[model samples]
Target: MNLTGWIVYNGYLPGTKFRDFAEWIQRAAANQGIRTTIYKNNHLLSCLTSDSVGLVDTETRPDFVVFLDKDIYLARQLELMGIRVFNHAEAIAASDDKIASYQVLAAHNFPVPKTVIAPKAFYNTGADTIDDYQKAVQLLGFPLIVKEAFGSFGEQVHLIHNQQELTDTIQQLQGRSFMMQEFIASSYGQDKRLHIVGNKVVAAMRRHSASDFRSNITTGGTMEAYQPTQEEERLAIATAKVIGADFAGVDLLIGPDGTPIICEINSNAHIRNLFDCTGINAADAMMAYIQQEMRHNHGRLADLP
Candidate 1:
């Protein structure tokens, strides 16, 4: 009954409520008699084990790896090693890149915002500007969002209302990769945060912030208990499956048309706000699920093919 738990880092760093939530999960797992390991660096090479039944890393590797990052690159490496990574690499990769995420979700009939990937050349400074920005606006429309290809905690997400803002932001992000997406107007100020574990919707909350444009609690948003509608629950599960995440925090924004658009899918979701506001103990639930999966896999290994 030995369980090895690895956290990306401590949950006490500045503006990282999710990190705090990870710590809470670690504590809760300890209370349940599970062994845990916390990694301060965002590297997976140091955490692999030859005999451990399970391994959790914010990055990817072989040997029972559980990835906690939104990036999919690590998942692919782990998958290549024949390890079972939650949120398979392909799914994480697709979700990490906004343009790719929207394409995959749309292909599968998932509701996602209209999005377009700006050419890398556009940010080159020496490339033609009008054509690139025009293409972006044509595909994604005005009042758009420009997000760094890989970012989290709502840090690199931006809302651009007009051409001036878009130009300024693009210039500021010069030489960096980014994606442009149509801002869901109805989701202007609020959205639902759904936390999923295994295949079930474990805890859900409605997030709102008067002072910030983002609903992430790390961005100063307030959270309250929310009972997801049937459609919302289905969308959350579908998004998780599509993204290949065993556990995830799915952000669903209600469009002006009252449709829920998948704004973001967080592989390493924070549980502190949900726990504090809803009393759901998502950390405990996740630990239990991981342990159960480990046991199930170990049993199968004993039988061999």
Candidate 2:
């Protein structure tokens, strides 16, 4: 077998985004002469029995998997079965949750905006069990960001201008995990994206919006190919390395001084937008990285077991 693999994407999600991601990788794999099959995550059941772990009543396993969905248990199970997974389960877990990500970044001494994670509050818990959230205001001040910990495309992010909005946001987000962060006014309507593969940036872009504070391309923001500064490149690569992502799209916001600040890291970032703006196929870089790491050209999957 010449590096047979599976590219798995979420099945429940509508639209073509997930399918497109898989196709891109498949095309790149074909160029490398490696065969890869596209699979919907649900089609491959995460099998668990009394004494063994695998996909339940499934087809023959591949040598490796490029997982595009946030299925931590399924990913971990694959690893247990002697298959290599790029941007492994732990990387996805850390990147998927905003609160967890910030905690890790802060612990590693990365430059992130001042943020405060809300404490655990359940539906059954009384309001008295939760803090008044005056602490978040005191720490982050006015015009801050109230972002849900597990959202994408900036849909669940909010800008709170004062105490009233902060209180209302917390009340609305009650029983959910979220964070309060300092809003970088300078970065409003603009940010940078760097696609990192194996400790280096393969493609970069600047996303800008005229009417919104968040500069996410999926949310109607515009983009242009960008040449990252030496410092920006270093920071992006370092951020990806810290989370152990084999490939990632790292988003950075401009600080007041025009320096870069870590906004977030995306373990399974879509490459289509970057391709449209930069004419760079990050999928190629991804396949190449996988080949190098697996030593596929050398004809072995020794890294897995």
Candidate 3:
């Protein structure tokens, strides 16, 4: 069976790490004999228009759509058309929103840090008066993290240590919906990222950055192979299940008390690091998974006929 892969993102400009990784994924898929296609965000939008626009042609519609940086809005439309999409739209939307992700994980009894959600308007106004400042403090104490609702690769995360810093940061973030979470100093310098595909933990790594607090490899962090404890694995799996992602990268922070708290669940996880560090053929596994799903679906259709 022929399988088509799509990388959903805006056009990758040269010299960006994301572009490099995207190309690597494409090459890996090619080596596995999968016909891959890259569709940018604007291309997907243009696909819906009457101009017959976008990279996806009606005649060449793919069997599976692997969204890289694509929006979650296309889930239902594609699902109804019998396309197998990795990380369905609902899962993507939920995981993309930090507040929503935390809520889902917490509801499922997954350990996450104390978090507070604020409207963009409230945060933009800046808490000048003591009462306003107190309100903000009451929600999340000092040494907190402020993050935009939707961002990737650790681009929109900020750490605030005091009232003045907090105030200044808030003022700077005007007009953005953000979430605040209590910072766990214990996890200040290190964290583990577990890459899960289907029900298996294919590869894992621990990231540490001397110059940055965020352990995202894309953000100048150093990566090493990680073999997590049984407890950590369990927590990572639970977090993945809650997010409903077939492929996920679960970030777990070690709290002061040695508890592993779920920080974030990435639906469209980067597989390059896992491949580079652990020698796991994650792209091949992903392609195989898609082929299996396609065969299963085809069988179901035949039975119906």
Candidate 4:
């Protein structure tokens, strides 16, 4: 009656962090009597042939897949073959791109910082095709935030204090997808990360940095276990739902007036930091949720071989 699944991650990424994420999920699944195999994205092939479309040499398909990497194409390919994919491919893609995620949030009336997506072009389209700097400056004012659409751990986020800083940063990011956002000065060096499973916030933590504008734990910030306010919980859960995430790490910034505002949504959030800060194993909660999803879909753990 044990469930079977595959925890897929990007093998191309350096260091043990990526592999470690898969391993943690594997162990958590094991704790719930679910058997899971870890696979690198390169370990499988998504074959397209006139006669058939499938993954090459995939003998037995698992009941579901836990995608820990941002391999959207592979995730979609797996879905095409009839295997259930957690978080879903589209959700991953949306969360992977800051502009896309922000658009979704804005459409849903979620409270996200004011953001302006840069124009698309192979080369820096120059000021001719891009938004007028004066207009952007007027909207967001000085000391705004600039974020590359595709980045992680606050590495690609920059704080621009004036027009020259914005210009230089944009020049360096030519041909890249990015956005300019309103700076939340009150939460400059602090934010809350809430891990959501199903429709509830399971574990929460507050991260703060003494020397930087970003408070991401991966960027030398300190974290402490936190109890989320009702508004914070509501915003986090809503973000996950709108993004179609089964589980996610939702960052909330404290507004100047103490209101909760979404900073970012991570579809494949690393749970180790959350566990370290709160003593709650989000992986365990995710596994349990996956089991319930299977059951709700009329599939039983006994169906696995």
Which candidate's lDDT is highest? 4
What TM-score would you give candidate 1 relative to the actual structure?
Answer: 0.81
Task: Give Cα distance to truth, residue 129, candidate 4, Å.
Answer: 7.9
Q: How close is candidate 3 to the true structure, as a TM-score?
A: 0.86
Residue range 1-305, candidate 2, lDDT tens digits: 46899999999999998999999999999999999999998998887889988888786998899999998888898999988999799999999998899999999999999998887767534344225677778888889998899989999999989776766677778899988899999999999999999988999999999999999987889999999999999999999999889999999999999999999999999999999999999999999999887776345534555
How many backbone clashes can be found in candidate 2?
Answer: 0
Backbone clashes, each candidate: 4, 0, 0, 0
lDDT of 4 by residue, 1-305 (tens): 45799999998998999898899999999999999999999998899888777888888899999999899999999998888999899999999998999999999999999998887768765544324566888999989998999999999999999878888888888889889999999998999999999998999999999999999877889999999989889989999999899999999999999999899999999988888889999999999999999887755556667
lDDT of 1 by residue, 1-305 (tens): 56565554432345655455556767877887876655443445433566542235434332344455543444555566566665566766776676666777888988887777766754456433655689778777777898887788789999998888888888777787877888877776689999999889999999898876688777888889999999999999899888677788899999887878898887777676788889998877787787788889889999997
Which of 2 and 3 is the better model by TM-score?
2
Candidate 4 Cα misplacement greater than 4 A, ranges: 124-131, 299-305
lDDT of 1 at 152: 80
Q: Report the CA-based lDDT of candidate 3 relative to the real structure.
A: 0.76
Candidate 1: residue 234 Cα off by (Å): 0.5
* Model 4 local distance difference test score: 0.91
Answer with 1 or 3, whichever has the higher TM-score: 3
